[model samples]
Target: MAQGNERKSKLLGSGDIVVSFEFFPPKTEKMEETLWSSISRLAPLRPEFVSVTYGAGGSTRERTHATVTRLLRETDLKPAAHLTCVDASKEEVDAVARAYWDAGVRHIVALRGDPAQGAGTKYEPHPGGYTNAADLVAGLKKIANFEISVAGYPETHPESPSVEADIENLKAKVDAGADRIITQFGFDNAHFLRYLERARAAGIWVPISPGIVPIHNFKQVSGFAKRAGATVPSWLARRFEGLEDDPATTHLVAAAAATEQVMDLVDEGIKKFHFYTLNRADLVYAICHLLGLRSARTDASANAA
Candidate 1:
């Protein structure tokens, strides 16, 4: 391994780190207001793109579409609308894809979403829908030249039989025309690096960006990690052990923890990241600034790409 000092010197190498954010479709008017407020603050960062997530079983189809199209119409940010095969037929999914294409939205984060029954349940694709993410990718390609992003699981998807199988699944998606793979949120940098090494060995070279979730609330986030099949190391838990009632301390710790995580990955020569914003902007915005990104409009001519 390279020496820590040696790695630190390259933290901002060439000064370009492609970053993206993920947001869920808001479920209520107040939540919608908060989502737009967060967007207004983060839009200044000029991420490579911001994505709107579809709910499980295509539940947020209309909200996701409206939010995505609104971003396209009202802001300068590129919006990637998520498409999934969960409860829709192939034709219905294709129709949605066509509508996005017509709206001038070109990026899609295609997923084989979770079963509507929720986590730990088996995912059964709609009998007439695309069979999986790979199938969805292939179908989207036929509809239009959309930039497709598919999911990768650093820890191996819970339902997958093995790590090798997960990589093979990801490779299948890439081979089906996915432009990139954005991992499910992960906390351990080693897991991501190992996944990257194996993926490269298998000839899957499309940019595989690690999904980074800033731990604004360790309790809530750890719960998410557990459900998503990610490990929350004891050390991480210890850091937040006694901070549950301390919001100020938690905020500081959260920012520092996420910044350190990104810096570690940057030292490993990783240049791309996708943040699970959870519709909160302050922590994420801070992390981006720490990553050497300034507001693009603030310094467009010299901003990090």
Candidate 2:
């Protein structure tokens, strides 16, 4: 719709908005350095909290734990650890949740992780384990008063047989005590708006935060989006066309596209956003800058470090 620059100044001039970011655990030492660099850069922005993703079947369990623990001790930002019920038994998952509590983490992004084989593969819950995200939410609640956020698929989850089924699944999660739902990253504003309408119609009132992925690496992001069942607008694909070799142009278009997307959502009365920050801080940092978010050092209590 409207470009970020074309939006009214007042719309772009709000006080620091409530924002959250998602990060994946680093797989290597070098990547670890980059991850922390991103954390340090974005930390000054003062997100509501930053979440570290859990890998499929708890593949990254140890790495995720290490990353989150470091965030607790190294930075001033609050950390939300992602816990998934994939291959683990109910007791195992509960123990992990207890470990998080012991580590001082109170917020959890509870998920029914991807199939161990991978996305698009069949998911079979471990015997005596959570059958799905709703089950996981209920179990986590028993461990502690976790501020749980669950996943929502704007476009039906790829594995879901129908959109109605997907919505029903999300409704169940909310009923199980989910505090909020963060959608998979989507490019089409209408898709998200419609999803919100449907969620409200279903009587699910939790904050369904739209996930924004500033598409810096277009091809890679497009592939991931497809797997996650997020639609890529044709207009968006064209924006990134012919820029495969030009990283600079890709970054520019990505920032503009994401800023415009969030502005449109804001115009539609959405006040909060969750970003999948692929661990490089600049693009997400720039998008937040355009959204009127300033460094916490100058204004808020985020300078706890």
TM-score winner:
1
The C-alpha RMSD in Å for every predicted model, in order, reads: 2.4, 2.9
* Angstrom error at residue 53, model 2: 0.3
Tell me which residue pairs clash in candidate 2: none
Return model 2's CA RMSD, one decimal: 2.9
Model 2 is weakest, by summed lDDT over 10 consecutive residues, at 7-16
Tens-place lDDT per residue, model 1, 1-305, is: 45756865245633577799999999999999989999998888878899999998888999999999999899999999999999899999999999999999999999998898897688887989999999999999999999999999999998899988999999999999999999988888999999999999999999999999989899899999989999998888899989989988998898988988988888777889999999999999988888887775768666555
- Best prediction by lDDT: 1
Q: lDDT for each of the candidates?
A: 0.91, 0.89
Which pairs clash in model 1? none
Error of 2 at 117 (Å): 1.3
Q: In candidate 2, what are the lDDT values of residues 1-305, reduced to their tens digit? A: 44556644336653636899999999999999999999988998889899999998899999999999999998888999999999999999999999999999999999998988886578998988999999999999988999999999888888889989989999999999999999998998888888999999999999999999989899999999888888787888999999999999999999999988887787777878999999989999998888888886756454553
- Which residue runs does candidate 1 get wrong by more than 4 Å? 1-5, 8-15, 300-305
* Residue 7 displacement in candidate 1 (angstroms): 3.3
